[model samples]
Target: MNIQHFAAFRAVMMTGTVSGAAEILGRSQPAVSRLLDRLEAELGLALFERRKGLITPTPQAHRLLDEVERAYVSLDSLKNLASRLAKGQGNQVSVAVLPALGLSFMPRVIAKFRQDWPETKVSLNVRMSPTVEEWVAGQQVDFGFAEMPVRRSGFETEIFSNAPYVAAVPSGHELADRSCLMPEDLREGPLISWTPFVAARHLLDQVLVTSGVRIEALCETSLSGAAFEMVKQGLGIAIVDPYTAVLQADERIRLIPFRPAIPFNLALLRPEFRGSPPTVDHMLSFARDLRDDVLARVPT
Candidate 1:
């Protein structure tokens, strides 16, 4: 009939008497008997036989007990799983990230996160900013890091990093000696630039136009990391996000602050329909710390 009836049946079978079952269940003997009676009426099967104030389990009762015991085992396992998940143990955290951060910044964050939560697994998806936003909006991942001005509807965002872009110049280039590079300065050399379709590229173009600077385009790339690679090969100088500059800078390349500060804004996006788990919160804390550390080292 109900959990109480099943419980009574189980206890009586275990103890071999209604009085013993009542003692175990904190119920009166008559109450236990009534539970058994209701259970039998509901199932249309007799679960126990009683005579001269003694009770014995029916054959059907033993079969029902086996099923109930199996159900209880499964319920116990589900409870244990819930407890582990609440404690942030043995779970997976999925995150989508822009290529700029994924190539450099996020790996460090994940390394630090793993030190603290070794049992938690992480799935990192590296994609373009728009794709990262789409994954978050679609709930394909737990959360995402993308360039700001996310245009998706199904996710909430928090500003993760707000820092100015920097110029990555070959170490042998004359502009590398300058304290900072302005849009006008880039006109002196072939410039490795973002593709015209990227939002940051449009912003860079506006700044260049405002500064009355026109530079030769050496090549075009969609990824800041790719631009950094081009700079390292002495192809040309590139204006890149600070995260990429900070991690990918080498002896072959020099990082200089970019004037008119094209701010590279990054946001963290989480699905509105999903709740933040402890694992996600811990990972976010690590990511924020790394962001602050990198920003602090950004060329001013």
Candidate 2:
């Protein structure tokens, strides 16, 4: 009922012994037992049963422990946040991104952000799209970047950028001579592609099928950057977002537009309960400027 009562209850339930709880609470064993007894009397429920100097939690105690731990964890987080603010290091932002964006696009944005706000700290996590969506919905990060149209509630989504998928060919490969590629052009070669579960893969499959083009698949990968690497190694021609193609471009690989353009889209997401930090808005503006410039010259 009171802070002391809750603390005693938690300490005793957690440590499973009156002496251990007493040590944790900086009290004598008798004092700890008295606190527990008072709490039980106040609530008119037995929180623990004791026999032979061992303490065992009652059913109600087990049910209450989870809520108690959660409250303490939140309090601990608040304490840490206060400490950070005291040290003048609270200007921090966290973002969750999918592998495709993390590979190169986000690194560029981070660098630009640091250039402008040198004192601000940025944390980035590269995870699957579902995880990114979940983090955004849960307010775990300032925002998240992921594939478009995340259907989860409790988040607002906006278009980040869009570009067409392009073909990646190894230097001196037969397709390198072509300025643009068609599905039929890739039919004779082994295709390096994303895993089947990827949205891009669904689009690619539809295009190939509708064009009556089929090819042997050399490999399927989760990361577009990995597909680009395979292309550089002459594994096969790969279809990837223009951002990745531009990032991985070199004399060893050529990026060309594929016919019937498959759009690569992304979204900026924010939780409904949290307002975007000014820094986040600024970063969003900076990223859009960079995206416009980069996408304009994406080699096709």
Candidate 3:
């Protein structure tokens, strides 16, 4: 029997009369009786005993009612879960981010996200850009933020930021007084640079080469956060993404625009294979706001 049959059976058992069941089910008394008959025949058990004008449930009906009630309870719970999910109240979200954004920018986004979705847990994975791209391509996380030029096939990517890289100089340094820095300006002091593997480093190298500027690096790091730390210690100045330079800028560091702009591009990656939940979309909204705020505050 189908759900109508089960519904009739439940209604009849609850009310103890076909007329009462009919009223509850918005069907005629004979329609409800027929449903009970079909259900009993399908189950191969007499569910009710009929008297001249009344009905009494059999022991078999009582036993079957227990299972039906449990099933209905489970169905109700499933409906509730679907409702919550549709409203963007999912349990948790997993995100992978490059260190440039993860160090400061992403934290602010998460903080703003929590204000609206405090109950949803957030799992933040801070990795290198390549690792972030791999995680997104492999569907290991719900979404990711990474450097641009993701070659993987299983991602829906959007360019989050395409601002120029900025020169990060230590406070009191000779170059700190310069409002903007060119490739040639780096020659005056030691330069802290990204390792050759980084995509931004390749772009910066292209600009330096095109301008016929070259300088030996005092040190190299794979992470912009580390580069910022090195710059903080007066070790050397660095050219870093605008996000990292703006957020990490403090009394110890100065941010200057880089000439012949080497564009620092960041991308937002979502797994092509998975449906994005409401929480993921909300988190992305927060990220967009943070990107706009940082870009607005960046020095020219």
Candidate 4:
């Protein structure tokens, strides 16, 4: 299929009419319409229906649109690559981060990266822990920061920081005044928690096994923040990463380092099959700088 025809078809779909697409693409309406026609002929499917001079999307068009938009995103990424290479800015970075890091670390990294490589174009893709590893190993993304362990086949992983896990407890709880807590501390209480699929849970489970301690997950949830709220409301104590511990606004909960120091280590997952892109490499360095800056001020 013709890429130009696809682009034209996409433009028409986005702009709602041939004339509107012409305006956006700076082409004549007839030219846009012809390209769209060529695309439809090739696909043997009508993309739109002409109703009272207005082009309305067909069932097939709507069905195909989501996939087409993803194609456009990839195409746009490639276009930016070409433009950056041609201009020789010597700097551009694209980094994908997990949902947890998006709250705090990613923003600081982006700011510092821009300062060092002012000409760089930074694109941030915030994803879940599972996706972050896949993106790096698959080479679909340049870099990723996640709260999970690195398990992908073609990626190099390192422990940037051993993010100690903490138990968030209500202010009136016996352990709230303490700086650290053990698994046995909440053996009698309900556990507000994260998914069992997560690394944090894995580590906690390991610790529980050796301690012969298993607290009932009376109220479990997928979101760390939401689980924290459950504890703040005196429902249960949750084992959460330090990142979320600091961001939550509820004054009723205290963040105490978990005993046995179940480490929620952070890593930079990079593609193993290919050398990193120049921009992506720069972003990796930027991320390291961001990590160092954060560590300097945080309590040991």
Candidate 5:
């Protein structure tokens, strides 16, 4: 019997459906079904009896699944070990970072990572918080760089910094004269917001709700850079992450500190307690170095 065939059978039996198995294995439904068919053909055992859109595990299937499951888990552990041995100190890192931070924060970290591990090739994925969380939780990425209060399951997290909120206003706007603005100051004028689902948007809503600021949102955009650009054009005022807005250095738009602090936690994460490949470990170590060096002097 083929090992992979057994593995597929185990996944299908455990998940109770081909679609669920496909999700875990990151394959298409038809592909997973084909694998299951191939497995049954090779083993000469009908592992599951399908009825009424549900998979019924046979007694024999249940008995065989236990051994197959253990074998696959052991193989996974051995694969991790062998991969680490094969690399023996390599400089390739695959990482996922939230789009908000990826724009400004990752460059400094990447530069430091490159300097320390000259051969290290760092690949950065810019995704939303949910996507980053899911990728790390799924063990699809070696590491994830993102704002904390995230929804990642089976992961370890370490906070690096508190990313503060800043008020972005046109250089000559009335509120621009003030060194800082209150949540109320935001509502008085047309307001710009990020996409409603982003962490910043949630934080903004929380701040507004707590402060009793029923600020009207003139527009919502996905990018802070774009929001700040609109503010610079005097179209409206925006509150955005200091990291992304600070990078713009748009003299036309000033970054003013805000009261009733709005902050997000930045963290480094890895899947919970799973042994990392040597390349993964080296990259993680270097990423922390890069994070510390860059975050320390961000001036936020």
Candidate 6:
């Protein structure tokens, strides 16, 4: 039950010999052997077999090793965390973002944040809105940028932008001449769309029903980039957030505002329990400036 005994056993299991384990532990071979003997006695199990100066783990040792390694992994993570704290690198910010913002907007925010706080460590993860919300609730991240209306109750949510959705089409498509499109305009042809049940898709569905316009969806995708690619391939036209349109706007793709404006809103999610880390406020200041710049340039 002693931690030292477990350490000795883990070292022997990893190194395959008492002498090798001794070298790793900075102890004599005989001392490591004694630790192993004590561990085996306490556990009432034969952990290894020694023969011809070679050591081999017994079946019981292999079974115990699974749990041992799992524990050590947690310990190693704690050690790394402590090392970071000791080095004054604990003023870190971790953010989770949905694909659209992560791809288009976050890089600008991160770059500006780094310019002001070069010593701060920043980590960004691109995930689905639900995953981002879960990370915020779990305190696994300092902040999350995701589609708005996150269902969880304990987080502070702030709408970052509420631009209208835009239509993505192949650059030379017939509709490219128009500055904006109505649902009826898109209803005529095959459309690339989000699958039913997606938050944005659900909202769009209600609008379609209300407008008496049914989209002839040829293909559905979860990622904005994928939908944009499908549109570029002439598969179909797609309605997407302005942020994605801004990132993917190119000679191959044309973005036009969608009429009646399905508001493409994104928000920041931060847990109530953790309170905002000071680094989060600093990061958000940079993010707010970037959001304003992006909003001004993207299609209305």
TM-score of each prediction: 0.70, 0.73, 0.69, 0.65, 0.64, 0.72
Candidate 5 regions with alpha-carbon error over 4 angstroms? 1-90, 276-300
lDDT, residue 138, model 6 = 64
Identify the runs in model 6 with alpha carbons over 4 angstroms from their true place: 1-80, 275-278
Q: Which digits, one per residue and each the tens of the lDDT, describe model 4 over residues 29-140?
A: 9898889788889999998898887888898998777667767766777788888889886455667777666766677767776776777677788877777776677566
Clashing pairs in 3: none
Q: Relative to the unseen true structure, what is the C-alpha lDDT of residue 47 in candidate 2, on a scale of 0 to 100?
A: 87
lDDT of 5 by residue, 154-270 (tens): 788878568577788888888878877888898666888877766778888888899898976878898876787788788888877766666666778877777777885777777
| RMSD of each predicted structure | 18.2, 7.4, 18.6, 5.8, 8.4, 8.0
Model 5 error, position 111 (Å): 2.2
Clashes of each: 0, 0, 0, 0, 0, 0
Ranking by TM-score: 2, 6, 1, 3, 4, 5
Off by over 4 Å in 2: 1-82
**TM-score top scorer:** 2
lDDT for each of the candidates? 0.87, 0.84, 0.86, 0.74, 0.74, 0.83
Model 6 lDDT per residue over 22-82, tens place: 9999999999999999999999999989898888999999999977875775475467568
* Model 1 weakest lDDT span, ten residues long: 70-79
lDDT of 1: 0.87
Q: lDDT of model 5 at residue 16?
A: 81
Tell me the spans in candidate 4 whose CA falls farther than 4 Å from its real position. Answer: 1-73, 83-90, 229-235, 246-252, 273-286, 289-300
Candidate with more favorable, higher TM-score: 3 or 4: 3
TM-score of 4: 0.65
Q: Over 4 Å off in model 1, which ranges?
A: 1-90
Instruction: Show the lowest summed lDDT stretch of 10 residues, model 5.
Output: 291-300
Q: Taking the tens digit of each residue's C-alpha lDDT, what string does model 3 give over 1-300?
A: 499999999998888789988999999999998898899889899888888887888998899998787667547545655776998965777889988888898889999999999998787889887778877886767899887787676898988889988889988899899889989999976899989888878888888899899878979998888898899999988988888888877899999888888887788898897998898899998898888989997876
Kindly indicate the candidate among 3 and 5 with the higher TM-score: 3
